[model samples]
Target chain A: MTYERPPTPGYDLGMSSSPIRKEVDGALLAFVARQRPNLLAISDELAPLMAALDALLAEGKRLRPAFCYWGWRAAGAVEEDLDGPPGERLHEGIVNAAASLELLQASALIHDDVMDSSDTRRGQPSMHRRFEALHRAQGWPGPARAFGEGTAILLGDLCLAWSGEMFETCGLDEERRRRGRAVYDLMRTEVMCGQYLDMLEGTRGEAAVDTALRVVEFKSAKYTIERPLHLGAALAGGAPEVSAALTGYGVPLGIAFQLRDDVLGVFGDPAETGKPAGDDLREGKRTVLVALTLERATPAQAAALQRRLGDPGLDRPGVDELRQIITDTGGLAACEAMIARYTGDAERVLAAAPVPEEARAALNALAVAATARRT
Target chain B: MTYERPPTPGYDLGMSSSPIRKEVDGALLAFVARQRPNLLAISDELAPLMAALDALLAEGKRLRPAFCYWGWRAAGAVEEDLDGPPGERLHEGIVNAAASLELLQASALIHDDVMDSSDTRRGQPSMHRRFEALHRAQGWPGPARAFGEGTAILLGDLCLAWSGEMFETCGLDEERRRRGRAVYDLMRTEVMCGQYLDMLEGTRGEAAVDTALRVVEFKSAKYTIERPLHLGAALAGGAPEVSAALTGYGVPLGIAFQLRDDVLGVFGDPAETGKPAGDDLREGKRTVLVALTLERATPAQAAALQRRLGDPGLDRPGVDELRQIITDTGGLAACEAMIARYTGDAERVLAAAPVPEEARAALNALAVAATARRT
Candidate 1:
């Protein structure tokens, strides 16, 4: 299903965002349309690749691009002043660059699904699962699962490569591009590194809360938010102070976003989160929330949690039991408190940052939505 | 465990290659060194990632870089007159850009190993095998195989991302960089597309000989030779005709090179090939040779070949039996004849192209070595 915003209070930006979302979506569609011929040139059979990518790209909230667009606006591009050629060009560049983030995010999600063996994404079959079903339907030889996984890996690599290509071709001047490229390059590296750490932590078992937070910082805070804002600011030729301020605002808010995601993973409605609730528990995610739960749980509870967590077959009843234990032990409450604190910090930074009022207000609304939404 | 040139007559490019190889290796080391701190900032545990990448980077023959460098030379860059500041800078840029190809190749090889489920690469345990061993050593949770495969996937991604970063930072002027970037972008997309086709072909059983050759053309010919030459020519501001000439010379030679590889996979000595003899048979690679045998084999022979191919446990006798069928069916001879035809075509193109004498000599030598070497 496409990303439909839930009717949650205090989350709306109070602006009809359809046009802006349309522009972002339009950029992605055009880019993929450009790739269709090349993919067909390889083989007509490869056309399904473009379709699969289109499906994956269709459902994103464009959250990264929103942060990027707002960050660019905050860095001094006037909302209603993009009428001159120079302003228009800059605006277009911002939109295209922001759109590139969605492609990058697609790459990450596709690969992440393969790594996690996820069966679904965006409320549809994950890329691998989709391919697996194709293989089975066609009675293809070899292991269907391996073919699906391998194809997904290549597709992800293609998206990752195109992310850089799209950003480079976004029509930014050399100076602005160079600045953005630094962030872009480092962001890709750091995110991969963060993912490696996340994978590593999963194997080590019962990591310290601090280590889990570090994973969150790199994997979520920096990748999903801080770097996107920095990329936008850099593209806009924002002052160093502006970048610093954006980082200050982005990091805390990103942390809150991830913290809320952790909460949603355990307790949010499946319909709202677009994921099976308690997935983090089932997948044995070494999240800060789980770490906190371990730290706070009694010996018996901790043993029980350890026994049930990471059990792939853990059912709905088991999920409820785990949830009850987490809440009873105040693990959920502590996680909620941390989310509130980070949200407060983000709001404080946004207010102090020398950003334009229009962007500030939108960003404030986004922060509320990101942290407080059921999804 | 390292790529070593095979002995061949009349194929030597005079002057010891140690200096050239060192420069390419140095470029990779410096680039990775620059990324080390950024990686560590994500987590000190990422140190293993750096080490793994370095090891994989260390052993390659740098064949693609050599092709790229010689291709640049073929585009009319003077050999001994690169003393002026401008020339020196261009030379540095060429070397760095050529080195970037090696990184891309590294990414391809690592990912290829994972997809093929190969146990070894360049005589050592493949990246996934190394990681699997590490997982076992650490007594890490989760399936060791999955952890290993997942880590290899991410490492391949990091290398792929870094390839672009290094290419962009190779210090070419914007115009030249833009020219090269076009080829670079298409090359990446096409190669991944080719990889997908190759993987797809593996599952479709015995496809037509033409289909298998199409896979070869994209997966190896264009990617390994033609595009690299075009990229080098582009970086040098070579005329359109230079690109045309390079393509004329590159495509046929690349095909021959891949044909030689197919032969080596089946018949070459293990020590010389640095891969197990009959590795291709065990992997059930859908090469042109396999296609040819399938086309020509009697019913019983075809059944035997189909049954033995892709069997992971196919032993030496099984390999010998398959080899006998291929030889009897004229598959091996036909493949050799095609290789000879392409080699002839490449030599003819080199003879007629307007590329200068020094580069022509090197290109002739490389073509000979590339197509005729046992390894």
Candidate 2:
């Protein structure tokens, strides 16, 4: 069921090759491997924890870290020139910051999968599902739900704790370290607040759609793109204006990324998305697409959708009908248009920013890839 | 139904004159009150979340933070020390660390409640129970259990994340910050390991008695007493040997503290403990007392005990029979004796530590008070 990614396009004409991405990934993998012994000593009973973490970590594309490294590079950092020594310390700092973003992403996913009650992620069984199976096999008390959640909660907390530990121990300059703290704090808080908004929208109905979108911007957009890029820029000792400019581009790009995800949630094939089609509809997820569909649906269609929404027993026909209604109402097209608008806006911002022309071209390519991702 | 605490002799020693505990408590409460606005801004949907966290935080005795502060004081930190100002900043550092401990404790409790599946904590409904109520009230889809767990897991993750933010943001000396990181990491890893061992013991049966004891030491002892005290001492720039000396005393005291809690889990009245009597027995918690009971019980008695060990449907008569078996086999007395031994050993360690005589007296008194608490 794994969908192979398309080959990456060539770098922009003006930009030269940099070993930043591979360097960051290598350092992070080595650091994590070094901590493995200590982690093993901590949980011999839960030996699978390490393996699970490794697998989850490996699934990520090092996009965030690349932004972090490029942020530094754009801030006038260069690798060892033929006549100069290597900037080992600066490179280390960039790698550390990059590694943190990946860790935070991993933490979010572990908790998110449990919150969404997802059965599969990245073409594999979800962590909660794996733990739930173990709970059932062992005949644990109360129900499998308790054990599944207990493990997920602990696992997420462990990731957060370790992420902080990594940030603290990453030998970065004092100024950059202080700057990084502000970004990290904002990112974590935003995610939590966004989660609260999402939950509220689900329960309170459509009265809060605007608020829900704001939550999406602050929570998912800021955390996923804007902040990661901002954090990397801050770590590279970028000027305040540079961070602001990056955010201008990153925010819209982040929105487009999530908007695309919402579309995929319903229309995406099960094999490619690693989720059953119309899963969000069955879960009653209050996404913008759902909101638009509700606003546009006929009275009869709206009533039928409402009846099926949040229904755990929703079957194939119900899913098909809901999808058809959404499509017929033009909600899908509107969502697609919104994604395109945001992507265009991000590219415009990038064009106006004072970044290197070559970097801008690469960044524009990244924006297109992110927004146009099919699965 | 309230069980009266025994009036221990010399319980009021220095209580009438001591202003240190009162000062620290005031500082902590004031800081928390000021931060209310910040917390409120982070969540509009999760109303229950803030309320539950507030209640849980309110219930903490601040015993760990108290130990930390005292450790600092014992290491020659004077109220008027010319080096650091006395008013807000220094106090905020200590309060932040204290608050971090409280938040960490909350994170552990949320996960533990899910793991244990008990209905109540601190004379109030547990977080999972609160979430379950919300699920039922809203008529949410799927089992209420899943919703309850999903909310609790997210809530706990938020607490862990917030705790790190607070710790990182707290203004403290670099040396002290480094020390704090070490203690925090150890504290987190130990608790998880301890939890793993605890879970394993329940499944492995009587053969894990020694392993269970080791779990108690790592999970409760090091975390509850040793680390907090060390963290506080280290913050005040206490010599490594000084904190080491406190550890010498804290470890045994922490073990005794857990031993007493284990005793209360079975024999203590529900009114005093705020949990149903023999709740641990019903849950089949594999405590030292349970291990002892199994070692001493006759084969027929052991069979009967095993039948009711994890029986959620065990009636009052069944619980009574289990209690009788524990008492008749002298397991209760043996447990009490063990508590006494550990407490006595803790006292000896306190006497042997290189602390000032006055500090030693205070620590000894605190140890006695901790071991003798009714709730």
Best by lDDT: 1
- The all-Cα superposition gives candidate 1 an RMSD in Å to the true structure of 3.2
lDDT of 2 by residue, B1-375 (tens): 111222541222222245544554564456445545655676555556777777776775566765676676666665555336543366567656765776678778887887787788877888889888987898865467766766677777777877776676666756677877788887887787677667656654542457768888888998888888887777777888888888888888888888888888887777767788888888788888888888888998888888888777777788899999989988788888988998898888778877766676667767766778766
TM-scores for all candidates: the values are: 0.95, 0.89
DockQ of each: 0.76, 0.36
Give every collision pair in model 1.
none
Q: Model 2 reaches what TM-score against the true structure?
A: 0.89
TM-score of chain B of each: 0.94, 0.89
What lDDT tens digits, residue by residue, belong to model 1 across residues B316-344? 99999999999999989999999999999
Among these predictions, the greatest DockQ belongs to 1
Candidate 1, residues A313-349: lDDT per residue as tens digits? 9899999999998898989899999999999999999
Name the runs in model 2 displaced over 4 angstroms.
Answer: A1-20, A70-88, A135-145, A204-209, A311-318, A356-359, B1-35, B39-43, B74-92, B134-145, B203-207, B313-317
